[model samples]
Target: MKVFTYSEARQKLSTVLDLARSEEVIIKRRGGEVFKVMFKKATPSSPFDVPGVKTNATTKDILDAVHDSRARKLGI
Candidate 1:
């Protein structure tokens, strides 16, 4: 963990953020107000991130459905 004054944090914002990626950063104001910075855990990407019509449809089935809908809309 690292501690920095408010002015230091403002001047070295980028460095503070880079360090925060690995550890916690504490900022202390002149009037004793303090804050901490930390990184949130990243979420892993998934192919099924879409929301709607939850079915056991395969990828090909979904693609075909989308194509058919678009064709209808375009009068093709």
Candidate 2:
């Protein structure tokens, strides 16, 4: 962990960011306000990142069922 004053952090923003990636970087203000900088891990993007549905219905089966229900409701 490292500590830097607000002005020091502002002057060495790049170094502070690099240090933050590996460890904690704290910045203190003249008025006694303190802040910590840390890196956030990003989630990997996926096409199949959907909620789970417990059903055995296929896509075509679902479409056919919808069409049948609509036709029956319309009496056609």
Candidate 3:
């Protein structure tokens, strides 16, 4: 764990944050108040990142299915 006073933390804010990514960081106030900092994992942006079902399908099979669905026919 790393500890820094308010003045020190303010002076090296970037360094403090980089250290916080790996371990705990503490910031102390003159009045004896303390604060903790830690890294938070980022969330995925893609909706397809969700869990998938087991499948025996190949890439060609999947693309062929998509192509068939999009094909035009005279009789609808």
lDDT of each: 0.93, 0.95, 0.91
Best by lDDT: 2
Q: Write the per-residue lDDT of candidate 2 for residues 1-76, one digit (tens) a residue.
A: 9999999999999999999999999999999999999988766578777668899999999999999999999999
Candidate 1: tens digits of C-alpha lDDT, residues 12-63: 9999999999998999999999999998866658877655686899999989
Q: Given candidate 1, what's the lDDT at residue 12? A: 99
- Number of backbone clashes in candidate 3: 0
Candidate 3 per-residue lDDT over residues 1-76, each given as its tens digit = 9999999999999999999999999999999999998888777789877767889999999998877777744333
Give TM per candidate.
Answer: 0.54, 0.56, 0.59
For model 2, the local distance difference test gives 0.95
For model 3, the stretches where C-alpha displacement exceeds 4 angstroms are: 45-76
Among residues 3 or more apart in sequence or in different chains, the pairs in candidate 3 whose N, CA or C atoms overlap within 3 Å are none
* Count of backbone collisions in candidate 1: 0
Runs in model 2 deviating more than 4 A are 44-76
How many collisions per candidate?
0, 0, 0
Question: Worst ten-residue run, lDDT, model 2?
Answer: 42-51
